[model samples]
Target: MTSSAENSGQPVFTIIVLGASGDLAKKKTFPALFGLFLHGHISPKTRIIGYARTKMDRPDFLKRISQHIKNTTAPKVKTMLDQFLDQSTYVSGAYDQDSGFLALEQEIQRVEREAKIYDRLFYMALPPSVFIPVANGLKRNCYTTKGINRLIVEKPFGMDLESSRTLSKALGALYREDEIYRIDHYLGKEMVKNIMILRFSNQIFGSCWNKDHISNVQITFREKIGTEGRGGYFDEFGIMRDVMQNHLLQILTLIGMEAPRSSNAEDIRDAKVNVLRAIPEVIESEVLLGQYGKSEDGTMPSYLDDDTVPKGSKTATFAAAAFHINNPRWEGVPFVLKCGKALDQQKVEIRIQFKDMGNAIFHKDVAARNELVIRVQPQEAVYLKMTQKLPGLGMDTVMSELDLSYASRFTNLTVPDAYENLILDAIVGEQSNFVRTDELDEAWRIFTPVLHKIDRGLVPVEIYPYGSRGPKHLPEFVTRFGFERHAQNYSWPETSQTSVAQAVAALSADSKL
Candidate 1:
């Protein structure tokens, strides 16, 4: 089924991991590449290069990467790791200068010897400060003219609309939009990727996914751990820029957008952009910001307590805001995006609360509003809470869920890391999961004014216990958007820490087998 010319023309992939000595490279980037290698997605001839300012020998690099790679004990996996490490080489360099880039390019060309075409995939794992400089250097020095050249960038794209547009212009000067992959790794998530399928493929969800059936939608991102040692970085961006602008907003677009013309990248992105453009600017009154205080257990420190944070810093560790889309599908429907650090729990989910039934025969008994919840992490699931008659003979109604828990239902499930999926997508020239330039610009447009207000002291940052469920006003904040919690307490069994670990371990075991 294969021709010799076609086989010979297969691009020789060269992956250069920028900021290779950084935590992201060790914890996520290298691990993801290794995962692809183990799964036979990466070709044997592919050359993996690591570039960073930190000077480290090959052994040290291998050890750092090995900590994140799983199943190294398995015979086949051991061979793969050995080969992967063998293929991996380190390059120490400054981002701005041409000399370093020239040296790096020399190394790449050496490995790519004899190949007529060189496919270069540069993964920018560094911060925004050096993004432009690095791109300039790569374009002038290392970019291949023969084959496909893809640049994969990580986010915190920019602080707001102006900054995002500026970054886009800078990158646009060096590369074509299709050659640049701006990753919002959330789009690579299993359930997040499933949202389109869940909405478009399923007749049940597609029929009622509008303002009439949905009262309000809430997208929440919670983190249990505080900024351990990254307070300096966290303070610079705060929760809104760090999470909401890129991660949460991307998820919101996917959830709120109309069905695409087709599954093509640009078509899906066009649909998302239409919904984003319809959203008016986020208002000051509708926004709630907060900084975390000490934990209730008294063992944890407050956000300001971190040595790196200024003593009187007003940086918000938590933020909750509501956006109203002016389009036909989501008109008047509030989409609340909430995110926080140092919270009581760690989870991300989207909750779509439907309007309450009017004048029901058992109105008093059926006080619970119908809700469709899609859990994004820590045990992925989707459940709809609907009023059901009590199992007993009594004429009473109770709320229950029609649930699909990934762990329980799909015993053979092997959910890939978000980065792994995105990396593979990048290698295969798929842009659907990556962010488009206009999408980033539109996202910043919706929140720029609110961000300015927060920066200008117009929005007061409330204080909540580090280990508590966020600010005391969280309930009031959600209620204002018409999000109703069932009167009775409903505890999700799999939300606990132990259960999450078990599910993850189960998935890991399945992946190895």
Candidate 2:
């Protein structure tokens, strides 16, 4: 762990972003850094240096980054941007060569020479193929021996279990576990970050978060859009390795893990690792793999139709896995994880279904089963749906929710983007929301068997239409794993729409006056 003296007391450091020309860096990395600067999260002495293979002048580089930067309309934000970009510089570099790294080292040296403390952070926004070479180059040519040095690694860590382990071992040889931050952006989400507080702080939930009260848990990731010209890269990782293994699995561990011993990063991470270790390998029968086909109206193309994706490729764009934990708290509960591209909607959420009521007051219209849902995107919310007595009625029950919707409920505050929160966490040396090496090991161990079977053609990928809900067999798959479909249709109340309508009405009234 990095000491307080090394990480704390008003952080002053230089951020080196590798693969600055890549999509991840342009879309997420720089925007996050700008957000931190806009919010006064970093010291004035802090600097940002961009490293990439594509050579460009300072204005060209700034122009590329400007597309992702926002809030420039505000004079204050414009002033901040002027200052932030002034501290920024760019360098063109080959990932494998020493000359570029030597140049990078010189830049770091120049930044350190001007400051009393020398702290550095290296953000690897590049692909896995170049991870080792870049790490080697950085360590050999640019490691800061003066103060703290942290490396932030982005996913897909590796293709499968064996490869993941190999990559971890190689990276381990260069960087200490504490010095490396394996980022799963989902962990930095507003609702996800609130999970610990919601679980441990409230007895209403903490007391009953177990197999006794919970019947089943579903962690789902669905996207509305298909690969859309990115099938070449998507084919390499697929949905399993891309989303389910790291992103969805991280959420499941949080929901199933026992309370941490302390607020320390290691303690929280240890709890998550324990949860992953308790899970048995996902069985072949308990798995469902699917690929998206053309839309019903023939408006969209199938995964195989993409020229970049090999013809007749069997790579799965969707995967559903049912996992059973061996631990006492979650022994009988099934943790069903599902992720896919080109689905009915784009949503990421955790749904915990409670035990069904057996013969309540009105047997004919039995009350809807209780469900606690933590919506992670589109609009952030934590809501519990329970049966309630209908107002001004005789012994009638209807579903109602005790909801906390971020959009309407927290109108004054904006939720920081996941990358922003994560980048800040990395700068401050917080690992609680990041993936630890052991956690990754356990995660890969749990899914490697199924992945192998699919890769070897032992298992076949099912087909679903683009722009439709995932596999026709998804219902049966969920039911097989004990997820009960409710007879009564239910939907959470739309608070955001109502808030917008009310605001519009108020403006209209003011105009009339």
Residue lDDT tens for model 2, 114-210: 7544888999999999999999999999887777889999998888788999999999999999899998999999988988989999999999999
On the 0 to 100 scale, the lDDT of residue 35 in model 2 is: 92
Q: In terms of TM-score, how similar is model 1 to the real structure? A: 0.94
Mark the regions of model 2 whose C-alpha exceeds 4 Å error after superposition. 1-8, 115-117, 497-513
**TM-score between candidate 2 and the true structure:** 0.95
Deviation of model 1 at 169, angstroms: 0.6
380-459 in candidate 1: lDDT tens per residue?
99999888877897967777889888877776668899999999999888898998998888888899998998988899
To one decimal, what is the Cα RMSD in angstroms of model 1 from the true structure?
4.3
Instruction: Provide the clashing-pair count of each candidate structure.
Output: 0, 0
Cα deviation at 31, candidate 1, in Å, is 0.3
Error of 1 at 136 (Å): 0.7
